[model samples]
Target chain A: MMKTSKIPILKLYNNLLISIQWELDDKTAMQFQEDLLKKIHETGATGVVIDLTSVDVIDSFIAKILGDCVNMSKLMGATVVLTGIQPAVAITLIELGIELEDIHTALDLEKGLELLKELED
Target chain B: MSLKISGIVEFIRMHRDEIMKDWIDRFNKADAQSISAESDQIDQAIAAEYVNILIEWSKNKEDEFSRKIHEFSKRIVQLDWPMDKIAQCLHTFEKILFAKLLEKQIPGDPLELLSEIEKVTSPVNREVFLQYTSSYERTINLQKMALQELSAPLIPVFDSITVMPLIGTIDTDRAKRIMENLLKGVVKYRSEVVLIDITGVPVVDTMVAHHIIQAAEAVRLVGAKSLLVGIRPEIAQTIVNLGIDLSQITTKNTLQKGIEAALEMTNRKIVSMGERR
Candidate 1:
């Protein structure tokens, strides 16, 4: 089932790793949330790196959904790493009262992927 | 008989002289009434003069007290300056982000304004706000670090007697916030009876049920009672399976019934006082 999301999944190293390039807009946010959860379960992915640099607005609801996505993915024995969330976006999420401390983010998608690989190791 | 009359008049002179001396001494002291009788014109004049002086002195005393109060307030405002700063951190981040966005959407020297703010605010605040702007994780962590992040409201909105109905999912984090919000609201409103309608809540698990109870307890801590409404069958089953006691909190089947219970608890009859008219 195409679980209601347009986010691309890059299967690298012969399906050893998967990266979700989540180009989240205002409308596609909820879809990303549901689809990501489904993919995490279906792939039985070891680690998932979410590239969110394209997402401009980090509203409270989106921030919460991100955290919940992390929690849900962790429950399925997969680690979720977020990347490309600009420094400015992080600050806004903080102001919105969304605690992103436990949710790791990196400057670029590559670094985030590297970090996720490290977690896998 | 002549000598007796002369002696009697002499005794009267001595007593009058002594009384006059005493009144004069008292009149020299505090400006209050001399505590002497105003039987004659002279005594009446002295009493009136004392009353007039005390009137002027009383006005002076009042002015002095007013000045002292003003000074005390100024000192207090200056003394607890950090408390205000800390409280601002607890709340103003919302406005801060909004302002920054507005600045982005407008044309202005946000840097100059930020500098001005830095001058007025403490180093800690500047650091926190700066981090809130520059580093996302640090900002979020700083905000989350605050255990009691809620600020004391400058103005009391709802009297402790006001009611606020909460609806939706109640997670542990939300429960805490709800507890804080309810307590803050009850205190703000000075509300005696709180009607928490749960009709809008989609579902309630063990944690959710516990949170509702915690929120009720928090309300009571702030001197208010609560009536929880609209516990769905699924939620009830969850609660029973979890074996949590909500008996400490009063619950009703509907929002209407909860409001009625609140009225009853507050000893407010359901019929409006204007009904008699």
Candidate 2:
């Protein structure tokens, strides 16, 4: 069995920044979800920006988990902002007919933070 | 030996005018029934130059004759003459000249001289035919490029809002172009909302809907919202009948409503002034 490293969720100015730089296998994605929730609870952050700039492929299962994470975070009173979704990934998700309607998306990390700020305001 | 050929060449050259007049008369009579007015003018103007080139086709003037034929072929293509007519005219010129030489009894072997004449005019046919096909290929390529340019056009209508009005039938290749142009326009225009007006689109099938959905998602990914406008009653029915889910993306019945929605998204609105007070 190959070992998996945990996806780190960094804390920056009361918001969590998770820039996924590698492909997420099923196990790593689930682990990342759990760790993110734990970190959100520990820091009590109200906004989370998950950047998928480097992620190219996203299957339905991974997409479902990501959607669930947004809902879960919202339940905890934190607004989640998905940022830096590449063109190819957007096309793939659309082709798969997986529209994360409940989720808010931004062009990049900068815009994501601004969107979060706007929502807070 | 060469002097006899030159003498014969001079003899043929002396009767050039009579040969040209008869040939043109015959050629024009044969084609007058079918020739258009514009083409008749071109044929009249080009006949003199064509006769000159044919008359000068001999050992000393072979190079000049070839060059003239090249120019004549280019002109014929520009005039839009049929390929068969060009070859026929050249053969007619040869037959007329050969007959004239025999009637005049020029001092040379008629068979040998006929073979010599063949050498000159054969290139004329080959060159004209080559030029004809190349010109056709060029025209086709130019038209294809023009069609591609007219295919997809993204126009910015307002501040932070752009509209891409689509018309005609949608195919996969055109859809791909639409997607690329949408994403590029979104970033370039810094548009917060994009209204895709499909009033001119005739029919929308599952494939077209899928493409539009994909384009909308791509627009969303680029940080702009896409609002589909101009969904006719029949199109709506087709969507429902096909069981296609378009609920995720906001849609409107007309471009006006879509623009209004876009304005609202960008926190703006058009206010109608009461009157000049």
Candidate 3:
């Protein structure tokens, strides 16, 4: 396994906080998706906050994977909130026709935690 | 070539007064209203100085001639003289000078004389016209910048709520500005809801609708809800007629309702003081 393929997912109370600080390749993103699902199942986390504050570029493929990850997390009884989406990345994703419409978004991790809490209630 | 040019210049010097008197006469006849006492004085001085400048230019003093012409053009443009007036004035001077030379029967090819006159005078005319156009373009750009600054203003009405009142036709450029201002204000104000009040927007075409939708989407991505307000009756009809999909965006008919919706989203409401003593 490539060293870069594994991104650490930290558990915080009933929520999983994953901050992606670097660019993600296909394998790493796929690995992240599986690891997040497994973690969610094992911890029985009710909320997930995926922070993309430091991740600058998100192409259509990654946007699609994110949207799918949010959907999959929902299916497994976990509410996923995407946080810290940069302004340029948002514009790029929208330009690429990936609205990520069904996902919840917050300005930062604290707000993302609040949103996740709201969804759980 | 030097001898011939000097001869021409000497001949012009001898009849400078007569040529200038006739040139002013022709100019006043063409545009009599422009002949004010101050301007007439300036024109007369310029007419005499122009002859001296050309004489120097004929001596191959090209640098002096170019600098002098540039200064003259800047002055003339500041006086707001129309380009045609300047051209006609120069043409009048040329006609009078040529008539004088012709009457003197100077032994030379008239074509060569004409070409020599063109070489010196064309630069002056070109410089004046160029200066006029550049000054005019500068004024227009300044006004455009002022108008653009006045067009979009984002006002944070309450905590976590900002209002941007757009008052004009929504073009692609203005829409882009609106989006930028909205996003920046949202981040700055930590606004959870942004109300874009377009009551003054005169039209809602397909392109305009698309820009608005895109702005709303961007606002959403930045974690702020974009609420479009002040959709007039005609604007509503146009959006529907154009089949523009604004279903994803939350819109209200008036800013009041939009503010209510925004306040509601941010978990706030205005309460009236009930009969305070």
Candidate 4:
């Protein structure tokens, strides 16, 4: 059996914070998607902030999975905010033709939380 | 073969003064403006040095001949002598030297003398042109580097707001540079809003519009909003005429309005002190 490491999801107030600290493989990404949705469902969090400050090298498949995760969280009534995306990663994603439109983005975790608060109002 | 080579070398040495005088006269007639622009003494000195180098090279000072030719070409190029002027100088010298060779009887066949003269003169001509073009290419490369350095500069005008004023036409290479610099500046400055002022840009065709839209989209992905500013009246007309969908991006007619909107987006505005007083 291959050990699949799960991305930890922390709950704070009515929002869930996830910081991807390493490069995610396909299996790990899929697991993270399922785990995040489960956490959103269990906690009934109204906002989610996914921080990719430490993570690098997101391929097209990983980008698609992230987009799917954002949409899935939205379907469950949680607003998703992506934070701390590196410049290289942003350029790569743009070059790959994945705009990730309609997704909220912030400079850092503090800004991401502030954006979520603004949306709540 | 050795005797023939020495004979041609001896002939040039014997008539060296005559050759120098004739070359200078013909060169002055051919390029009078350039010659008179400088002092007559400097032109005479250069021509004298050129004839001396040819005489030395024919006498079998191969290494010194090449080094002197290299330095001579570099000096003339720096002096901004036109390539045609240099060619004309070489042609006049060759004609004078061959005429001297033909006028005086030598031990070798006429064809052999012609070929030997060709061997000596052709290399110098080729070397001069080679140096000229290489220097020209070097200048072009330097200017290109300078232009690239000046291409995309991102300035942080206010807190959390940056401005990138683009001048000149935006080609694919420059567009790619603009996008990279804009995105990198946003992250580095932690800007919430960016204003791209294209007032200096003369033309906005469909391709340029597409690049702008892509840059705006990339900025959005990087967590900053991009506002296209400095749209001239004609640019606005062309944008609509081309059917470019700039509706998705916020654009202002001038940079001043763009800055105001940027400040407003960042939840701050400049209030006049006179009104408060």
Ranking by lDDT: 4, 3, 2, 1
Encode model 2's per-residue lDDT on B24-55: one tens digit a residue: 78888888788677766666677777656555
Candidate 4 retains true contacts at a fraction of 0.63
Candidate 2 total steric clashes: 0
Q: Note the chain A TM-score of all models in turn.
A: 0.78, 0.98, 0.95, 0.97
Q: Write the per-residue lDDT of candidate 3 for residues B82-120, one digit (tens) a residue.
A: 777777888888877777777888778888887766665
Which residue pairs in candidate 4 collide? none
- TM-score per model over all chains: 0.30, 0.69, 0.92, 0.91
Candidate 3 stretches greater than 4 Å from native: A1-5, B1-7, B58-64
Per-residue lDDT of A50 in model 1: 72
- What are the per-model DockQ values? 0.01, 0.37, 0.65, 0.70
Clashing residue pairs, candidate 1?
A: B158-B188, B158-B189, B159-B189, B159-B190, B160-B189, B160-B190, B160-B191, B161-B189, B161-B190, B161-B191
Clashes counted in candidate 4 amount to 0
Name the lDDT value of residue B252 in candidate 4. 99
Which residue pairs clash in candidate 2? Answer: none
What does the lDDT read for residue B10 in candidate 3? 78
Which numbered prediction scores highest in DockQ against the true structure? Answer: 4
lDDT of 1 by residue, A5-80 (tens): 5756665541223344544554566676677677766777767777665665677777777788778878878777
Query: Model 2 off-target regions past 4 Å?
Result: A1-9, A18-46, A51-80, A86-103, A117-121, B1-22, B34-45, B51-69, B82-122, B237-245, B273-277
Categorize the docking of model 2.
Answer: acceptable
